[model samples]
Target: MAKRIAASLVHAIETLFVIAAVALAVALLLPRLFGYTPYAVLSGSMEPELPVGSMVYVHETDPTALQPGDVVTFYRSDGAVVTHQVYEVDAEARTIGTQGIANKDADGSLVHDAQATPFSGVIGIAAFCIPYLGYAEAFCTTPSGLLAIIAVLALLAVASLLLGKSGSRRAGRRARGCGNDG
Candidate 1:
C-alpha cells in the first residue's frame, strides 16, 4: 500500500512538472513566431467591440494598407498608447483617425500625420480575445500574485509531508507488531 501511494505521488509530481514546462515554452515562443503582442483591454473605451478585461492578440501590419474600421494600437503624440478602431486612414495625407465605439465622440481630432507610423509600428492586433482572462494574468504579475501562488504551494507541500510522515509511522508500527520467526 505504501509503495502504491509513493508511486502515485511521484507520477503526479512528474506530470505537473511537464505541464509547467510546456506552458512556459509556449508563452515564450508565441510572440516571436506571430509578430503580435498580447494585451488585455483595460477600459470601456472600445466597448461593444472589446470589453474591459478582455485579452486581445494583436498582429503588426503595414501602415499603407490600413483600412477604415480596423482596430489599431498606436502611440499618441504625448507618448501614451491606445487601442481603438480606425475611423479613417488617409494614406496620401499620412494621417489616421480613431474612435471608441462607446465614446461620446471621436477621440478629439484625428491622430496627426507624422505621429502615425506604418502598420509595422503596430506591435499587435486583436487576434484572439477572451473575456476576463486578463484579470488572472494581471493579478499574476504582481507581488501579491506571487505570494498567492507560493501560499498554495506551501499548503500542498505541508499536506504531503504530513501524509508521508503518517504513512511511514503506520508502516513502522505494522512491522513491529508483526511476529515472524526466521
Candidate 2:
C-alpha cells in the first residue's frame, strides 16, 4: 500500500511539473509570434500592477495613437528601458508625460529640464504581463540552467523506467507465490 501511494504521489508531481512547464513555454513564446516583445521588470516602479520579475509584453504602436492611461515602454536618454503609465500626451510636440503607478510625481518636472519623453523614444505599449515568469525565462537562457534542465529530464526518464521494471518484478513474484500455494 505504501509503495502504491508513493508511486501515485510521484506520478502526480510529474504531471504537475509537465503542465507548469508547458504553460510557461506557451506564455513566453506565443506572444512573440504576434510581434510582441517581452521585457523583464527589474524594479518596483510599476509595482502592484507590474511586480518585479514579471515579464511584460510590449507591442509597438503609433505614437499618435497613445493616450492618457495607456501603459508604455520607452527608451530613456540614459539608454534604460522604462515602462510607465501615460499621464499626458502632447501630440503637437510629439512627447508623452509618464509616471509610475507607485510614484507620487510624474517622470519629470520643470526643474528637471521641463521635457516630456519624446515620441521617438517610445518602444511600445505594454500588452500584458506574467508575474515571476521573467526569472524563469532569464534562468533558462543561461548555460548552467540548460544543463540542469537536461539533467532533470534524464533523471526523470531513468526513474520512470526503474519504477516500471520494479512493478513488473513485484507482479511476477506475486504470481509465483500464488501458484506455489495452489
Candidate 3:
C-alpha cells in the first residue's frame, strides 16, 4: 500500500511538471506564432490600465473592421507611434478619431481632433497588454541578455542529452540483470 501511494504521488508530480513546461512554452511562443506584434509603452497617455513600460500585443487589422472604443496603434506624420482608443470611425471617409485614456486635450484641443488618422496610417489593433513586460523584453534584446539566453539554451540542450543517455543506460542495466546469464 505504501509503495502504491508513493508511485501515485510521483506520477502526479511528473504530470504537474509537464503541464508547467507546456504552459511556459505556449506563453513564450504564442504571440509570434499567431502574428501578434508587441510594442512597449513609453508614456502614461494610456494611464492606469496601460501604464508606461507596459507591453501591448497588437494584430494587423483592416480599417473597416474597427469600431468605436477599440484601442489601436498608428503612426503620426513625423513617424512617431501612438496607441489610443478609437473615439469614432467614419467608414466612408476611411478615417478614425482617437484619444488616449489618460489624455484630456493637447494644446487646447481635444486629442486627435485636429487630424483624424487615415486608414493607411493604422498599424494594428491592440490585442492585450502586460504591465512591466516591456522592461524584460528590452533587457532580453541587450547584448549581455542575449548571450545569457544563448548560454542557458545550450546548457538545457546538454542536460537533456545527458539525461537521455543516462536513462537509457539505467534501463539497459535493468534488462541485463533480468537475463538468465550474467
Candidate 4:
C-alpha cells in the first residue's frame, strides 16, 4: 500500500513539473511565434490600465488601419517607445495623437493628447498587457536570476534521471523475482 502511495506521489509531482515547464516555455516563445514584441512599461503615464513595470505585447500594425480610441505604441521624437490611447488619427497627414488615460504632469495640464506622432514613428499596436511581469524580465538579466534558472533546469534533469533509474531498477527486481518460490 505504501509503495502504491509513493508511486502516486511521484507521478503527481512529475506531472506538475512537466505542466509548469511547458507553460513557462510557451509564455516565453509566444511573442516570437506570433510577431509580437514584449515591451516593459517604465512609467505611470498610462497608469491604472497599464501600470508601471507591466509587460505589454505589441504587434506590428498598419498605421493607416489605426483609429481613434485604440491604444498604440509609437516612437517619440527622441526615439523612445511610448504606448497610449489614440485620441485622433489623421490619415492625410499620417499622424496620430495619443493621450494617457490618467496622466497628470506639468507637460499635460493643457487638456490635450500629445503632439501628433508621425505614422512612420508608429512601432506597433498594443495587443495585451501583463501586469508586473516586467520584474521577471529584469530579474532574468541579473546574475542571481540566471543562476536560479540554471539551478532549476539542473534540478529537473537530475530528478528525471533519478526517476528513470529507480523505475528501471524496480522493473529488474520484479523480473528476477518472477520465478516460482520454493
Candidate 5:
C-alpha cells in the first residue's frame, strides 16, 4: 500500500510540474515570437489593473496612434523605464503625458516636463499582463536560482529513468507469467 501511495504521489507531482511548465512556456515564449517584448513589473504604480510582480508584454506602436487611457512603456532621460497610462497626447510636439493610476497627480505637473516623455523614448505599449510571473523571471536570473533549476531538472531526469526501469521490470514479469497460469 505504501509503495502504491508513493508511486501515485510521484505521478501527481510530475503531472502538476508538466502543466506549470507548459503554461509558463506559452506565457513567456509565445509573445516573443510575435514581436512583443516582455517586461517584469517592479512597482505598484498601475496597481489594481496591473499589480506588481506581473509580466507585461509590450508591442511597438506609433506615437501618433496613442490616445488617452492607453498604457505605454517608455524610458526617462535618466534611462529609467516606466509604464504608465497615457493622460494626454500632443501630436504637434510628438510627446505624451502619462501618470500612474495610484498617483494623485500626473507624471509631471507640466506637459513639457520630464513626465511628458518624447515619442522617441517610447519603448512600446503594453499588450497584456500575467500576474505574479515576474517573480519567476527575476528569480531565474540569480546564481542560486539557476542551481536550483538545474537540481530540479536532474531530479526529474533521475526519477524518469527509475520509473521507466520499474515499468519495464513489471512488463517482463507479466510476460513471463503469461503462460504459467497453472
Candidate 6:
C-alpha cells in the first residue's frame, strides 16, 4: 500500500510538471503566431481605462473597423508607434484619428490616413491586460532572460538524466534480489 502511494505521488508530481511546462510554452508562442503583441503600458495616456505597467495583449485588426474609444496601436507620421484611444474614424475619407484621454485637446493631425491599409498598418488591440505583468514579460524577452531560460533547461536535462540512471539501478537491484530469493 505504501509503495502504491509513493508511485501515485510521483505520478502526480510528474503530471503537474508537464502541465506547467506546456502552459508556459503556449503562453510564450501563441502571440507570435496569431499577430498579437503584448505591451506594457508605459504612460497614462489612456488613463482611467489603461494604466502604466499594465500588460496588454494586442491583436492586429482592420483599421476600417476601428471605432471611437477603441484602444489601438498605430504608427505616427514621424514613424513612432503609439497606443491611444480612437476618438474618430472617418470611414468615407479613410482617416483614423486618436487622442490621449488626459490631453485637453484632440491631436493636431490624423494618425492614420484613409488610404492606410488594414492590420498591415496596425500592430494590434488589447485582448487582455493585467496590471504589472509587463515587467516580467519584458524581462523574459531580453537577452539575459533567454540565456537564463536555456541554463535552467540544461540543468533540468542533466538532473533528469541522473534521476533516470538512479531509478534504473534501483530497479535492477530489486530484480536481482527477487531472483536470489527465488
User: Against the hidden reference, what TM-scores do the models get?
Assistant: 0.67, 0.69, 0.58, 0.62, 0.73, 0.57
- Runs with alpha carbons beyond 4 Å of true place in candidate 5: 105-115, 162-182
**Highest-scoring model, lDDT:** 2
Q: Write the per-residue lDDT of candidate 2 for residues 1-182, one digit (tens) a residue.
A: 66667677777777886997898889888899999999889888888999999999999999899998899999988888999988889999999998887765455432221348899999999999989988888778789988988887787777777776877788887888843322
1-182 per-residue lDDT for model 3 (tens digits): 44345545555655665675576446546897898878888888888868887888889999889999899999866788888889899998999998877777656543654578999999999999888877666667789977976776675556555655655666687888953322
Instruction: Rate residue 121 of model 3 by lDDT.
Output: 96
* CA-only RMSD, every prediction: 6.0, 4.4, 7.4, 5.1, 4.4, 6.8
Candidate-wise lDDT, in order: 0.67, 0.84, 0.77, 0.80, 0.83, 0.67
Error of 6 at 19 (Å): 3.5
Residues 62-111 of candidate 5: C-alpha lDDT, one tens digit per residue:
98999999999999789988889998999999999998876654553423
On TM-score, the candidate that comes out on top is 5
Off by over 4 Å in 2: 33-35, 77-80, 87-97, 104-120, 142-148, 172-182
User: For residues 66-180, what per-residue lDDT tens digits would candidate 6 score against the true structure?
Assistant: 8887888877666666677777777876766667675553654434433342344566566777676666566667999879867766755665566667667767878888433
Clashes of 5: 0
CA lDDT for candidate 3: 0.77
Candidate 1 C-alpha lDDT tens digits along 18-72: 6764764465457658676767677888876788877666777766667777888
Q: In model 3, how large is the Cα lDDT of residue 142?
A: 88
Cα lDDT of candidate 2 equals 0.84
